[model samples]
Target: MSFQPLIHMFSITVESNTPLTPLDNVNDIAIEFLTHIGYLSKGYTPRSDAEDTSNSIPYVLFMDCFMKHPHKAWTADELAYELKTTKATVYRHINKLKSLDLLEEASAEQSDGKIKKGYKIRFGDLRKAWSFVEANVQMAMQNYRKTVEHFCDLMANDNTD
Candidate 1:
């Protein structure tokens, strides 16, 4: 089953440089922000010709568990058990969050009294974690501006020659 077809737009309108959500609750705010930034979406049902692209579990875990406990380090096994999903599934979502510079790896002692690799929002602060993402985005935009300016200069020189 492919989930590509089932994924649909979930919109949060912007007016005068501010976001406006149709629903004004914390969960909806989380969903709208995540959706706007390409994290969550209105997931699609898989088709016979498509790969099973169901994405709710990880997102739910993030919103309910990780976001709720941003100050705590969560192990993969713990998350998998909590969500009733596999360790692989937990890690897949973890890696995606890590890629966004929102999560950081740390070690934590589990209930079973063993130390395990874990993750928490970077610096135990989502706002701080997002600063890293914003910095990267700003740098990328600056690089693109430089590239465009260089290209224009090259074109001007070419015209002269």
Candidate 2:
């Protein structure tokens, strides 16, 4: 079996931007912010077949289920029910958040005495969760730097024309 780290591979766009005054509406910020962080698909356009595709499932999953109740540990079943989607769909979005290292697995005991696994924002806070993403990005950059340096060393030592 192959070993998989708790943190999965994720891509985030890094760009310098001037700080802007906060928007009054959360959705305005959420859509753009989520897209920027690689949570929502960039340049997303509504499908012709769907009338209200602008409110995408992933967006709802993030805003309604997670952000609205950051402190609550949500099970896949609960998310599916809340979003009126299937467990498979819920898991897909959950995995996306997990890949970003923004969600943490939490275990909760049901009234039936069974422990159920759930997902919540890391430490029930987005700010704390973002620190993990920053650390991962830093480590990845360091690794890339090492590779570039090694390649330069290899070229310097190569005597064969």
Candidate 3:
């Protein structure tokens, strides 16, 4: 995918003599900050292994929905409909995330005198998760830099001919 620049608005006052130069490297700075804090990373993947034989479509769909609406806890039926999958599939994905400690059962409430389980993302103490992402990203960045250097060396040698 092509890179899309992330921009933020800033307010300035002329009377106060505040510098008003537009941020030229805002995206770079923001990316660095997010990487440092482990918010943006390429480490996220389905919990299931290749040999497990479990389909990953439902897991991917549930992750998409959860990330889009992290604040709201969703029921299995609701998530299944949003993901265009069956309730059984949704439950399987939820179980995977729960195993990873990324999702938590937030509450068990009585609705129409019946107990309903509610699940939410584990946002209360995410330091461990953040650290995991940071370590994975650092490794990925090192590999990416090495590949770029190798490509540049090949191009330079070709140009010398």
Candidate 4:
């Protein structure tokens, strides 16, 4: 599927006398980078949509926990405690992430005669994912520029003044 840019149309105010801080610039750049890379659009809510009380909580919580210990594979019980949910819920979320190819089962072993499964974050393959995101961001930015130019031209032609 083609990627769509997530333009953040928010404004930030800063003192004119103060020099631009690295944090400020980095924030702007990160916003733009995330927008162009489609990361920001993943959780967007439609204007006319009703609230979705779906199974998003478990997935989000699982992601948060996974990020904290990307190298370690968490069992259903471990994830449940961290996420404040049930083991079954954690299992459901893990399955969902696995379906998305965001997480993968690293191994399965017998522990005390009981089978234990391990998982790892697949996107931690930073080199490859970063390269892919960079390319996608460039494409999205080009599209955004063209769109902005078209809108500006349209506004200029409109004699609303």
Question: Model 3 over residues 57-137: C-alpha lDDT tens digits?
Answer: 433343455545565567786677775667887786676555445566655344566556666666634455445444555
lDDT of 3 at 82: 71
Q: Per-residue lDDT tens digits of candidate 1, residues 1-161?
A: 86474332222222233465566777667755665565554453422232333336755667777888998889998898887778887887787687667888888898879898899889988889889777766766797699899999988889554
After superposition, candidate 2 runs with Cα above 4 Å error: 1-10, 16-22, 45-54
Model 3 residue runs over 4 Å out of place are: 1-56, 59-62, 108-115, 124-161
**Candidate 2, 125: how far from true, in Å?**
0.5
User: For each candidate, what is the lDDT?
Assistant: 0.70, 0.80, 0.52, 0.53
Clashes of each: 6, 0, 0, 0
lDDT tens digits, residue span 8-58, model 4: 332212122322344556444443433333333345442323243122344
| Number of the top TM-score candidate | 2
Model 3 TM-score is: 0.38
Off by over 4 Å in 1: 1-17, 20-23, 42-55, 158-161
Model 3, CA-based lDDT: 0.52
**Ordering by lDDT:** 2, 1, 4, 3
TM-score comparison, 3 vs 4, better candidate = 4
RMSD in angstroms between candidate 2 and the native structure over all alpha carbons: 3.7
Candidate 2, residues 1-161: lDDT per residue as tens digits?
99785554665666565443467777877877777777777776643233443377788888877888998888888888887788998898898899888999998566788889999999999999999999988988998899899999999999999
Better of 2 and 4 by lDDT: 2
Q: Estimated TM-score per prediction?
A: 0.72, 0.82, 0.38, 0.40
